[model samples]
Target: MARVVVDVMLKPEILDPQGQAVQRALPRLGFEGIADVRQGKRFELDLEGPADEAALARIREIAGTFLANTVIEDFVVRVEEPAEAASADNNAEEGAVR
Candidate 1:
């Protein structure tokens, strides 16, 4: 199986109140040195076949049309390697921070 990831983020000009709230709390929690934070959304899709050019194009279309708000947000779609996907799954199962 192939894993496709879609990441949706607000446009740089858009204000991110949620991200700003986290950034402000980070300092209170003793995590320092971060200049800024922008919260976003991630979508993972498992495909039955290879992630080829055609599949990528379809994914991009889906991302642009359904996954992101084109007026205020942008999205990127990518194929995730099996190893990397496995690692991320393991981390989630173990309650590790991303």
Candidate 2:
């Protein structure tokens, strides 16, 4: 399986109340070095197969249309690479299943 990661974040012009609240509380928590904070969402999707060019295009369309609000948010989509040992193990398991 392949993993698709989507990161959605509010546009700079938009007011992020949740993020602002966290930022305001940071100083009280003794995290004074931080200048600012912007909260975002991450979605990980496990696809049944490899993400080819067509699949990537479809994922991009999905991100733009469903994962993010174009008016006040932006989304980024990318294929996630498995860690080295995990990738090898997954490949080995697939070979055994075949």
Candidate 3:
């Protein structure tokens, strides 16, 4: 088993009005030193795999095919080994059970 973490964001050249709105709001909330802020989405998944290399390869495919847009957005993917993945899955499942 493997775990995949994915992050997706708009292209650099693309403008995020929502993010800009949040940035503008920050100053009023007494938060400073943040020159700018861009917002995006996060996804977490657990996938079965044959090996670390293969898992990462599959993760890349998943990101390109469904998790991210090759056009206006970019994605980052991370794959972890079975031990790590299983532990996290167990924790998540346990939480669900509760």
Candidate 1, number of clashes: 0
Across 1-98, the per-residue lDDT of candidate 3 in tens digits comes to: 45577889988898988789999999999999888788888897866644377777877898899888889889988655556544555455544422
Off by over 4 Å in 1: 87-98
Residue pairs in candidate 2 whose N, alpha carbon or C atoms collide under 3 angstroms: none
Q: Write the per-residue lDDT of candidate 1 for residues 21-80, one digit (tens) a residue.
A: 999999999999999999999999888989999999999999998999989998989898
Considering summed lDDT, which 10 consecutive residues are worst modelled in model 3?
Answer: 89-98
Top candidate when judged by TM-score against the true structure: 1
Q: Write the per-residue lDDT of candidate 2 for residues 1-98, one digit (tens) a residue.
A: 88889999999999999899999999998888877789999988888879888888988899899988889999888887676424555445544422
lDDT of 2 at 89: 56
- For candidate 2, the per-residue lDDT at 85 reads 23
TM-score of each: 0.84, 0.81, 0.72
> Could you tell which candidate, 1 or 3, scores higher by lDDT?
1
**Candidate 3 or 2, higher lDDT:** 2
Clashes of 3: 0
Cα RMSD, each candidate = 3.6, 7.8, 5.6
Q: Candidate 1: deviation at residue 60, Å?
A: 0.6
